[model samples]
Target chain A: MRATTIHGPFDMRVEDVPDPVVQEATDAVVRVLRACICGSDLWAYRGESARQPGQRIGHEFLGVVEETGSDVSGFRPGDLVVAPFVWSDGSCEYCREGLHTSCPRGGFWGSVGSDGGQGEAVRVPFADGTLVRLPADAVSDDRLLTALLALSDVMGTGHHAALGAGVAPGTTVAVVGDGAVGLCGVLAARRLGAERIIALGRHRARTDIARAFGATDVVAERGEAAEAAVRELTGGQGAHAVIEAVGTEQSMRTAVAITRDGGAIGYVGVPHGSGTGLDLSTMFDRNIALHGGVAPVRAYIPELLTDVLDGTIDPSPVFDLTVGLDSVPYGYEAMDGRTALKVLVKP
Target chain B: MRATTIHGPFDMRVEDVPDPVVQEATDAVVRVLRACICGSDLWAYRGESARQPGQRIGHEFLGVVEETGSDVSGFRPGDLVVAPFVWSDGSCEYCREGLHTSCPRGGFWGSVGSDGGQGEAVRVPFADGTLVRLPADAVSDDRLLTALLALSDVMGTGHHAALGAGVAPGTTVAVVGDGAVGLCGVLAARRLGAERIIALGRHRARTDIARAFGATDVVAERGEAAEAAVRELTGGQGAHAVIEAVGTEQSMRTAVAITRDGGAIGYVGVPHGSGTGLDLSTMFDRNIALHGGVAPVRAYIPELLTDVLDGTIDPSPVFDLTVGLDSVPYGYEAMDGRTALKVLVKP
Candidate 1:
């Protein structure tokens, strides 16, 4: 088997690696069917994350079960399934409370957890809690390309933003960022009954996709000007809810600044330290509700899984490009170079 | 009439000033029964609030309705009342939504609104929504000194903390301040069914007041040590709700860091942006809810009017001293010197 590895600044390699085997009784081995480079992956590619080199990279995948340990249940060899980026025990109190990301035994799929998901095959612990079954038969390459892959992280994240920000009927929502995840947020806001959806984007392609995903308007302005555009669209009151998809300082500030007084702002950007210099004084005066952090992707994947299966949501368009696993490194480079919104790697 | 006025840094004057009159059609005249110097008043006294010379300096007052403008209703010339620092119309959409502070016609008592409350007679606008009627008869001087005057701001702000933080039964609440507002927060938390209250304060008097109000423990520690103390008391999980009464960056950080994952932090402090940088990144990873700004004192005063009338939540002890309106300048200096928790001035 081959695995994608990040070995320092601007360096990515697809090299032959040992095939993963079930390491725990609750583990299952899965042969990767599809995986993708994430918007967040670009952070480490840019050497912005605390992530170290020589680590297995990638955390989103749809796969076929190859084998299962004794304690693993609900999954068997040859089963088609998707897994969330974070794995949880599923039975813990926190998991029961639908906060799987905060589950005591939960950890990430790549650098911060047991192992990475970039390889052709990998061991998935807590299989019952982590894997979601597909339609019994294998999905088509195109249908499964984006939706199943998105189920692993981005779609759930977008839903997390909409739900956390309390977007409801007639709500005016502003989505910050034009990435695949942000586009999905536009879709989520529309599905969640947002009366107005504005996507702030600098790229025409991304803005078109955002409009396709339900963005009612797109602002080409940047920084304070972009925020002013949002405010202007909102009648100088700001959006009722803002989905902060970008974690940079300016984006976070824009997210806060473009929300109306007593409005809610949900942010899922994996932010750096500089974004912390927010002014609570301004937040206090506005009576705004800031409710968000990292999206609890695992907790929301099940319902989103149903939505995808039932045809209520099609988040698959986030993957604008799909390629064989051999091109995984180029996919990372393309993402880093902003040539692709997101890349799906069929391992 | 005599009043307290700021001449310069540490320079306060007890001098005669023109008595207030209804300058607007919606205004009413209140003959001050008692006015108190607030912790925030000391900011101007210490020159931290950028005070201009000879500005009337107070905001907390309880008074009698001596006169009403032609448009004013709901009270007669003899009705005793407690005036919310902010005067709202109670008719606007924002007021209807319970955000009276942001109401279009609302007015703050001192720095940003119609008039200051430290004088012998204060003219209040939006008369119908700004004043909560007292009991039919006159109340005691001590009760007026503590409960009603303190309720004008600090006590109500403490209540804002508990309400914004969503404190409830079985909750472990951490209050980040030992000021009168923090002490009142302990009382508010207990009233809201918080099972454990932790007060972070080094002052002996404040620590005692906090315990008297319902705090189970007091942690004199600051910053990380204070967070550690809160975690130690909550089985290493931190408090379910954190109330930040001090608006400095340190208290904001303490409140954010001391809350459990998924907890709510209500900060009512008039924030000085220098503390903890209002770091939203750390807040993101924790999934904390930051809800607070200026207290909607007008919103709460009606219900609290009943509480004060019935002697249910005694806030009178917050006033450590009382002086006539002529001694208000002394009150400001005493409070600025930390020799007074709160100073009440009788007209």
Candidate 2:
């Protein structure tokens, strides 16, 4: 089998690797049909986030079950399913609370010994808890497949951001970042019935996708100007809910600045730079709530899946480029270079 | 008229001042019957917070309405009332949303030329918005008067903390700090039907008050030991809700550390000192939600007042020392010296 491996900075290779096998009673071998490059992967690609040489990479994938261990009851051979970025034991307290990311028995894909999602096959632990089965009829549709693939991470993450921000009917929301996650957040807010969605992004291509995702206004500005634009759009009060998907200090500051008093910020961007630029005194004075983290996408998958299947939201637009398994390195480069919003890899 | 004035650090004096009168259409003059030295006032006393010489001090007070301006409709001259620490225009959007602390037209009680609560009389702005009326019969009872005074700030602030942390029936809550607001938080959590309350404090007197207010457990250890003790008490899962009533960086860090994954921290200590020690990465990885700020006490006074009037809660225990008009300076010294948990002033 061929799989993606990281060999130091900017060195991604598609090389022959042993096929994954179900080794634990709770595990299942999945033949990945779809996977994608994630923005977080860029950190390691740029030598910014430490990575062991020749380590597996990628954490999002949807596939067909090839083999299952004795204890795997929820899935079987030929079952179509999608795996959340992290695997969890569904019965743990955290998992029961819908925070699968904190599941004690859970671990991220591509961690030291785990199989990466960008590979041809993945040995999924806690299979029954980690995989959500998709309908057989939908597997044949490429568009639906792309949308379903997003459920593995971006879509569910967007939903988590919306839930964190308390987006509801009649809410005015502002989303920071033009990445796939931010675009999906706009869709999530709209699906949750937010009356107004303001997207802050300088990229026209990404902003167009944001508008398609239900952004009523776009602020193609940065820093203070962006804050001013959002406040102006919101009648000088700022947005009721702000989604911070960039994870940079400035982006976090913009989220804070553009949040109305008593508003909330749902931040899902992986913190990579200097601390999130938060002034506790200001947050205190304004009564702003800060929530979100590595999103518990598994908890939100079921409901978001229903919407995706019903044509209520089409998040497939976030995947602007596609590549084959051999071109996985190029996919990473394109996303890192901002040439692609997200890259879909068909194995 | 006599009022408590700060000539400089450690220089609190009872001096002759002009009597308060209705100064605006929304103003009402309040004759101070009960005022208390707050933990926050110590900041100005210690010269930590900036203050002008001879500035009027104190913000928590309950009294009889002495006079009402032409447009003051909700209050009458004889009405007994408790004024929240800050006055707000109830008609503002933020005020309507129950975030009076962020009300654009609101102002703190002792700012610049405003009358302080520890005075013979106060010309309260936005009379209808800032004050909550108490039953006429209760004013004569010393105990009831003390409890009503607590509603003017501490009790209401505590309620804000509980609400911000999403306190609900069966929640396990932890309150950080042993001051009046923290003690009141323990009571507020209990009133909200929290099944278990863990209070983190070092002082015996304050912890005793906390226990009486419904804390089921007490952790006297500080720093890492306190975190370990709390985690141990919660079966290593930490508290479901944490109230950070001490605004120090250490207290905020402890609040974050003891919060269970997906838990929340509601902080109401007026942030002092350096930045709140927050690691965005930790908060993000744990999915911890941070909420709260300077409490919008005016919005919570009504509900807390109902509880106070019904004898359902008595926060007056926080007032361990009492002083008359001329001894207001002694009250500040007592609180600053830690000889008094809180001091009640009669003028």
Docking class of 1: medium
Deviation in Å, model 2, residue A272 alpha carbon: 2.2
Question: What Cα-based lDDT does every candidate model obtain?
Answer: 0.82, 0.91
Per-model DockQ: 0.61, 0.76
TM-score of chain B of each: 0.95, 0.98
- Reported per model, the fraction of native interface contacts reproduced equals 0.67, 0.88
- On the 0 to 100 scale, the lDDT of residue B29 in model 2 is 97
Off by over 4 Å in 2: B273-275
For model 2, report DockQ. 0.76
Any residue pairs clashing in model 2, and if so which? A284-B293
lDDT per residue (tens digit) for residues B198-251 in model 2: 999889998999999999999999999999999999999998899989888898
List model 1 lDDT by residue over A1-347, tens digit each. 88888788788888887778888899999888889889998888888875666778888888889999999879999898888988888898667877777777777877543557777987898999878888755466568546867988889888888877789999999999899888889988998999999999989889988988899999999999998899899888899899988888778788888998888887787776425535566777878777778777878877777877778888877887777878988898888888999998887
Residue-wise C-alpha lDDT for candidate 1, range B187-293, written one tens digit per residue: 89998899999989888887888888899999988779888988898888888899988788677777888888888888888877523646676777778878888
